[model samples]
Target: MQEFFMDYGLWLLVGLLVIIALVFLLSGRRKAEQPIEPAVSAEAAPPPAPVPFVDPIIAAPVAAASVVAEPVVVEPVAPAEPVVEPVVEAPEPAPAAPAPAPVEPAPAPVAVVPAVAVVADGEDDLLRLKGVGPKLKALLIDLGITRYAQIAAWNDADIATIDAKLGSFKGRPVRDQWVDQAKYLAAGDIAGFEAKYGKV
Candidate 1:
């Protein structure tokens, strides 16, 4: 330690001397800084060279953008319930009205009433002829004759047999008025025969 002190003592003295000279020089330079003249005044610092104002050139497209909106797609929804409707049927039209009943016309008036011929019950019409009696009347009716005109048409031989069979018609007038009346009725002269025989 004694050796290091002895060896640096001279160098320390020199550094101190140099430090004192630098202090003096710095003081002189600070005094000289006031000697430099300001020709105009404090405002003479040329207003920081006016920043050359240049407007930005931004280019934009002439046509406007086509702001097309996308179409909205809605998903189809399934039905949640089943619906049933009642059936309606049209009614049948009323039937056509029935036609009125037709009126029946009155029957035509009768002009004349005809007279009907009525033979007496059990009185033999064949008995009015000659040789015809109860027995002959029965036989004549059996032979399909119940009237005097039918008996009068019988020939004389037929009358004779029937008379002989009856045993007593001996004087028969079969060829007289009976035959004449029969001929008249056969000739469609019933009115004349009825007039002569008193309306049988």
Candidate 2:
């Protein structure tokens, strides 16, 4: 009995130590799982009455500016008198002279002449005539003489008139013997024309 009590007492002591350790660990777990209540202050002072937030940038209140008014006295002004200027009389202008009568232009002197008869056949190629070029042909056509017969039959007065009318070609008729060449051409005398002048 004594030996059994000694050996089993040591085992009971170790078992009791294990049970106490388990009880302490479970109690700590339970305490950690439970929700905790907030602690209350003794005199909360109503949260310090929520101190109004003031901006550091705002300036402190100052006394309002004072405005002083003074009385204004206006004096009455006197009325000014009007000044009169002397009037000058201008002399009347003399009557204007009557406009002179307009002078009439003199009547132009006109000469009567026979009208040029237009031939039924068109103008001939006077360029084929000796000393006759495009320019001379145009001048002859303007002078109403486009045919060889017209130039061949020109009288002294007609020649004089044509010679007078010729501006830059004044001496061409007499110098080039246009009448003789024209007469040969009018007669269709190619041989005579070639003999008198160069090749037709």
Each prediction's TM-score against the native?
Answer: 0.26, 0.41
Backbone clashes in candidate 1 total: 0
Instruction: Give Cα distance to truth, residue 100, candidate 2, Å.
Output: 46
Overall lDDT per candidate, in order of appearance: 0.58, 0.78
| Local error of candidate 1 at residue 9 (angstroms) | 99
Best by lDDT: 2
Name the best candidate (by TM-score): 2
Candidate 1 — which residues are off by over 4 angstroms? 1-136, 143-152, 173-176
Which residue ranges in model 2 land beyond 4 Å of their true spot?
A: 1-119
lDDT of candidate 1 at residue 52, scale 0 to 100: 64
Query: Global CA lDDT of candidate 1, please?
Result: 0.58
TM-score for candidate 2: 0.41
